[model samples]
Target chain A: MRLLYQILWKDHSRVHLLGAFLGTLAGFVLLLAGIQFYMDLKAVLSENRDLLDPEYIVINKKVNIGNTLGLTGGGFSEEEIAEIKAQPFADQVAAFNSNKFPVQAYTEGEQVPNFITDLFFEAIPDEFIDVKSEDWKWDPEKGTIPVIIPQDYLNLYNFGFAPSQGLPQIPKGVLSMINFKLRLQGQGRGNYDDYNGRIVGFSNRVSSILVPLDFLEWANEKYGYFEKNDPSQIILVSKDPTDPSIIRFLEERNYDTIREKLKSSRMNIILKFVLSFLVLVAAIIIGLAFLVFLLSLQLMISRSSEKIRRLNKLGFHYREISRPYILLLFLLMAGITGLSLLLTSILAGQLHQTAEAWSLDISSSLHGVIYGTALGLILLITASNVAAILISTKKLCK
Target chain B: MLEQDTSGSEVWEAESLLLEQGKPYVVEAPSGRGKTSLLSVIYGIRTDYQGLVYLDDRDLSSFSSKEWSKIRKNKLSFIFQGLELFDELTAMENIQLKNRITAYHSDERIMEMARLLGIDPFLQRKAGILSFGQQQRVAIIRALCQPFNFLLADECFSHMDRENSLTAYKLIREECEAREAGLILTSLNETGLPNIDHSLKL
Candidate 1:
């Protein structure tokens, strides 16, 4: 009845109801926005992964005092290589093969400055190298050794060393045209051979100077005299570079890698920690707001206790008398649901705009899970508040 | 059977008593004679008395709150001595609160009864601002707006003067006769009313 509602609704404290409404709304918006941002960031993190080939990580033992003193070998043994191959993150593993003999390279043409430098060579299977070249092969009869050096080496020389040394920076094509001779030294002074060497490509994946695997094997067989040592470095390909276990496993085994390669994996761990903490805080606020909602409604009902009993005496059932309170609860719940979703979507839009300046692709709309979570939580709060309302109202009636 | 533990009483001390339909019964007693308690018991609001009250062969104690609500709506009505009117509601709204549920009386008939009880000018005023006699008249009109086999009036006319009491009582009798319902009117002293076929001292 209109009069029934007018009578019962008059006793409600406007401050209490408004406080409950705003409190619940604030809690819901925080929770929903946290979820939306988390999903978007996760998507963006994985999206960048799709732009590149699978990650190749080069790992070596940490250099400590024992390794410096030559007391311990700073390389992977047969058992250690096998253990690394068995790891879940290792999709493919290859050990670096080094030259067992001494080597030296010198420029012979006037187009480049005459220089001779001692060098060491390391080689892995061709598939792990990022650079592709037809000249990356060994031919004993042709007597030409093709070499691949790190791109960072050239960059360091061009950017750091050339300007300080008053030398011109040579481009890659000019470097390729220069002719050089490599002298391989065996056990005796006369037991050596010289071969022509050429720079074929620069590698971004591996940091050391590289030669074709077959040429290194052949040269080691012919000129090797020093004691054989374990491989000093191993390169592994991982399809999921964002897997945090890659970093954890490396740390546990005292292995080191260029940390820039696993930046995404570290970011993923940190993002998960921060988002979970955000969700936990949201859950606590929501829980406390729910209590305020329950108490506010209960207080309203108890304030109307006399009118409810009077209505009951006039032939109104307890359920009938509880109509006003139930309607109020429903209205507030619906408002919270609608407003929270709107606020979360606005937040998502803001994040999308900010991420755009960084050239990151982020979704501006809310995910389906956001809607589902909002509805589920609102239903939960509304149902419990409704039960409390009915119970308190029934207590006041005959 | 109806029973209670009051000495020097006719209805309470009696082994059994039956109040029939289409009859007006006056319960006469001084203050503190359990007049309101007797009406409340019959109305299913009080169950503490040591007695068995029956309506149409059904025990009063057996009725659930839902059933009691239904009974109150269609089979029983009470004009409580406290009036039970919403103080914030206008007199007309208080009457319509009950009338709207039953839809038993039209607006014209309600206005006519208010005019007869001399509360017509105050119908639009809040019940809390009206005098006790005016609030009592509103409660009388409210009780008469429902369909009931029994009308329980617990000293409802105590606030009104003799003439207003007689006029309200006549209206009650007319409504009861029209529905063929019974009336159990309790009073603190001798009311000296007319057309009351039975009087019980409690």
Candidate 2:
């Protein structure tokens, strides 16, 4: 213990302390921040699962030169659908049913009458539809059709179309209160009818306008003049949205998917990659910092080599002389680890505040993964240095 | 047994040596005759030799490092020729260091010994700052601070004057007599001490 006091009171390598503190702090921050980003991203994605279901994906054919020049059909064929169904990743597949008849939609009961515009109506199986409001269903007996539109459409209307047309911007709740009229016509069959269409909800998942399958079937049966038409868009229920195989498969087939959900999935992959890369970099920097620590210790030991030899001549054992060095290293390592954890907590709290400003809920607690990794690094580094000091002191004793 | 130099040249040879308990032996040799090397071998500090050494019945070569440390701490004590003191420590600390381990003498006893050796005035001074004779007396005092069955002195009095040398020898002889320990003193020539029970010239 007296030896320990002497070693601690005398040994001060400022360069080593500065190097270790700054290097390890930087490495630890990068490691913790990367881990924090990954955790927050996962949390946000999980919370928004209703908006972007990992089990569902929007698939379309590649719009290439062959497709534009009419060399190949720009849609899924029966064989193509069968091929998709055979894949292990595709748990279920559903096609968007299109109304073969022409559609004319216009808003009614509004202060400023909206212009009548031609529109396309698509439908999917009720089981595949995410919206669960009572108004989302169709009753052909009542001549009322339920429709779901993209949320982006409302944003465009309120922010772009309404101002340009000198119409008051309408909020979503008020817009849902207003009724609309839809006109269906079969050109060659000379059949026409008007029905009441009501907006049930907005969809962030599916961008295209949606109506009930029952209404689409009845309308097409009564007014559609063409033969059964192939669907251009298909909804695929992938087993795992985060699977690299799914992305690779889509890329290999020269197919495209929904931009928003695909972006989310791609961001997840990129975050994982960045996390691993940052951890690797941190590991390398930590190794260097530990090396600097060891070099400093070696310098101190070599400086005291003469004293050690003298003490050995006086019948001092190696363990007794080297204990002080090992203790100092252990205390230093523990201090750095503790400071890093504190800094991480403070930084994580600031990140949480930033996320809250963006209307995202994120936790500021240290993630178990980051904690475990830091602890492992501290233990590994300290143990290695202790062993090295012991060995060197033994040589000195000899 | 022959003690060889770094070039493997024989420097000193002894056919037989026996040290009886409670007896003093003076080993005399000229300079560069491995006088210090002989003391080092007996103290278990050097093993690079061409012959076997035995402490009683056990061969010195078979002793592990721990065993050697035990012998140094409990049984054998040596005052090196160069007086390998910790320069960073004080003269008082140098004595206290060994005394702390051996606990053979109290602080008052150590101070009394320091006073008799003429080192009590520089007790708090760093060993590096003291004169050669002062440091030699400090080393002598440190060596005597420990309990031992054998005390090896390698020219410990070379830097001291005759009067101081006699005083150191008197104190060492009295301590050895009290402990029933054997004293091995290496010197360039005999001093004709009547108390010496044996003498070996290498």
Candidate 3:
């Protein structure tokens, strides 16, 4: 209405403009920041998938002062394994089997000169091994043994050990081609055996050299020196790693976990928790900002209450009296949202450059869905508040 | 007609005083005799009184605030004793504000009313800075800017001289006649209105 326009134009004040602009800007920032945090957290979680399996985790007994001084050893007892298996989250648990005899390995080939070194081997259940290479299976009757090595071991050799020793770094394809010869010595207590050892595959899940369970048992039996011993490390398959109870149980027992696979997953879990907490805080701030806007509206209306009363006495309906206020607030929110989106877009450009530098796969852009959600939520909350304030003002017209 | 009390006892009364459209009535009273209270009751601004007031045989007390607003918008206009105009607005703005409510008057008609009221020269002056008599003329013109079936004036001419009061009353009477509206006025002395069809004393 022309009357509504005249009233608004005549009553414009700096106080009103400042109050509305600041409240709207604060609310816009909170919403945009919260949404950006959530998106970034989602990207981090997705990137962690290549680092760790969600269902598989490796743990060992915590190393204490007694363990270092040889007063105790860092190994899992039978009762401890039984207790772990009884846990509700634990779907399956297996221990790493270590050879109990002295062993040495060497390679003699054209590309790889003869080099001899002491070696240790470990074995786990075939079902727990993620690498599906057919050659990984070993039989005592076979002439050669198949082994799986950690992928990072080659990296350490190529970057750290080989360079220091002035030797050529062994590429994965060439390493798999050469057969490693192993000699088991029993020191006159039992007969020694010589076997050909070949690398079958590399596993990201396990960080040690892996042999077949059958092979480790046969070799330990043939070169028996002492009684069988308990395992020092364990691999557990859980239904859900993100369950808080699982972490609590591990911490309560003072167990140490392999950080390689769990490093990124653990970070993801923590980041998700932080994301939720930040969103709740942002919601509270937004709620306060909305109250500020409503209070500003109340102050403006109170300043003009006398004119409003007179208008009402002249038989102008309540809607006519409140139209200008609702219109002004709607316009303010629209403007603030537009400015926030512009700023977010600019910030997203910078985020893309940072992501590229970090070698992250995340695309730095504001998703339309998130923008649409933020706009819808802001307008919905503000409109409801405006309607409530107007209704209360109308009630006071008497 | 209805009579009621501001204190414990009735101050004035009349028997079956009927106000019809296109008629004029004058109520005479001494000072502090509830003349303004009587006009306020008729205008639906005062309800804390005893006695029944009716319009078309419907009890006035039964009307809701919303219904009273409708009556004020389409059927009734009032000029209070204080000439209750927005003090911050100019004289012309005061008239234009009322016209905006009903849109019943054109610019030429408003100008003609201002000329008749002798307030055309002061139309641009703020009401609060002007003399009480000038504001009273402005309020009178504002009252006529809306469509009405009745016009109630509660000693609206107290600050004006007799000449200006007569001129303001002439414009009011002409506007009321053109719209077939009844005029109910109270005065401490004679209003000098012609053809007084009804009379009351309080």
Candidate 4:
């Protein structure tokens, strides 16, 4: 067997085999690294989402000139709301209900400055509200309306408004303690009623000033005079915010939302595209490398054609003659698999370190799918090459 | 039985000719008379003939490649006219390449046969650099390194001098007698060697 190897292996071109080895290794590293990073990024994207509650997306039509001039309504019609309700991503949908009458608020408290301001109110289903409080209900007998204001409005007043105005910063507890009166007015003169209003909670989900649904319904019935208009805002609950179709649908319909909320979904689409392209290029390289490997072995066998026939004449089977070639192929394939995996893991470790600087959690090791892919591809290449070696060597034998 | 005309031949034209074991037969024919072809057909290398050939009552063409491989390893041996030696291998390695398959001969026995054929000093050299006579002696030793019921020597001694040819023939005869195996030696002309009892002419 050693003599057979010595005689047969002498015909192989060293440069050809080395080129094949390096080419295959490069392809394997590319493929494995693509898979590794894709998995890690997907994990990181979902991990960030898990820190927040289920996604609530608020969508509104893009305000164009036509909407500003009243040529087209700046609101969602019944058909549009129904269509949004029918979407697969919208697990729950609600349209904002606004007060159909004018309202003005005045603070009459010693601890707070005297001020009067016009206010608008919107209402949605209580289930969609992020703040859960006992005071969020409507009681006509109590004559107190519970209002939920956006967290951003308060932050703006404290961080942007009050500091520049030389006004003292008010804490949330102090602000909620102030008493205010809301005067609801009817269409006719001297037809108005004043009721007490209290701030119940701050909402991170909805950007509008919200009141209870029942309270708004009662007030609109009492003081309603303006014509009805379609709701301008639609809030929907989604279980999986990383569905890229949400962004595509919004863009196609000319709808607008907070872009930061769907960052993961947008990142997902881009990641998939980049990874697929990487895999395609790697496949081409691996394919060409595989062809080179097959041809190189076949050429070596043909160069040793006379020697093989001589060995066969001496009672060495063609299978025996193929042993050296198969052994060489096995060694090269194993090396590619091992070295590619090692290189991909090293790249992953470097990526993990870089992501750590950004406080992004990325895995430092190769994913399990990377090994499955490498092993599966290596076996496929080795099996086909071994078959080719057997076939060509048999052709040379008696 | 071959594709050529066989009207004047003895073995090809005969109705029935049985060559027995433990006997030596010399097939004498001029060039282009199928001397090598006859040996090749019997060795199962050439299949262009029309008639049936049998080995121990089993049809020769009925054997698969695996069966032929086994027969070549353990049952039949041929010293091809082309000498079929690996030129890159040392003469001893070439011999051991065949001997390792069956382990039929010890290293000392191979060396003894090499010395008898006057090729002992050239055993360690690559067969490609040796003289044709030396390479022929190497092929002879390689052929004898296996166990076979019949030894087919296809003009193997054509390159050797008369003295070396006699010495090699003596060594072959001794090996054949020890195993009680038959010998079919093809030659272009008559060899006046003494012990061959049968000679067939083409």
Rank the candidate models, highest TM-score first: 4, 1, 3, 2
Across residues A71-178, which tens digit of lDDT does each residue of candidate 1 receive?
999999999999999999899999999999999998877676699999999999999999999898999899999999899999999999999999999899888877
- Top TM-score model: 4
Among residues 3 or more apart in sequence or in different chains, the pairs in candidate 3 whose N, CA or C atoms overlap within 3 Å are B1-B17
Candidate 2: list runs displaced more than 4 Å: A3-21, A41-47, A50-55, A64-69, A77-125, A133-204, A207-231, A237-252, A269-281, A349-365, B1-16
Q: Which of candidates 2 and 3 is the stronger one according to lDDT?
A: 2
DockQ versus reference, model 1: 0.73
lDDT of model 1 at position A25: 92
TM-score of 2: 0.79
For candidate 3, lDDT tens digit of each residue in A1-398?
Answer: 66545654455566756665766576566667667755765666555554345468888888899989999978999999999989987889998999888888988778666999998888999988878887877666777988889998888999999999998888888888888798887758557778899998888888788998988888787785755678888999975665556776788999888655455456656776886776677677667767767777777777777777776666666676788888777787777788777776677777778877877665577877668866787678667867875785586453
Cα lDDT of model 4 by residue, A204-272, tens digit: 989999999988998899998889989999999888888888999999999999998999889989999
Q: Write the per-residue lDDT of candidate 4 for residues B1-202, one digit (tens) a residue.
A: 2223356688878776677888999999999988888888888888788777788888888988788888899888999999999888899999998998889999999999998888999999999999998999999999999888889999989999899888889988888888899999999898877699999887
Report the C-alpha displacement of residue A105, candidate 3, in angstroms.
Answer: 6.0
* Per-residue C-alpha lDDT of model 2 across residues A36-142, encoded as one tens digit per residue: 77888787866756534556787888788987898878788888788877877788888889988789998766565686889899998876777778887777778
- The stretch of ten residues in a row with the least summed lDDT in candidate 1 chain A is A44-53
Error of 2 at A370 (Å): 3.4
lDDT of 2 by residue, B104-166 (tens): 899998899999988899999989999999999999999998888889999988988889999
What Cα-based lDDT does every candidate model obtain?
Answer: 0.91, 0.80, 0.77, 0.91
Q: Arrange candidates, best lDDT first.
A: 1, 4, 2, 3
Please give each candidate's TM-score. Answer: 0.85, 0.79, 0.80, 0.93
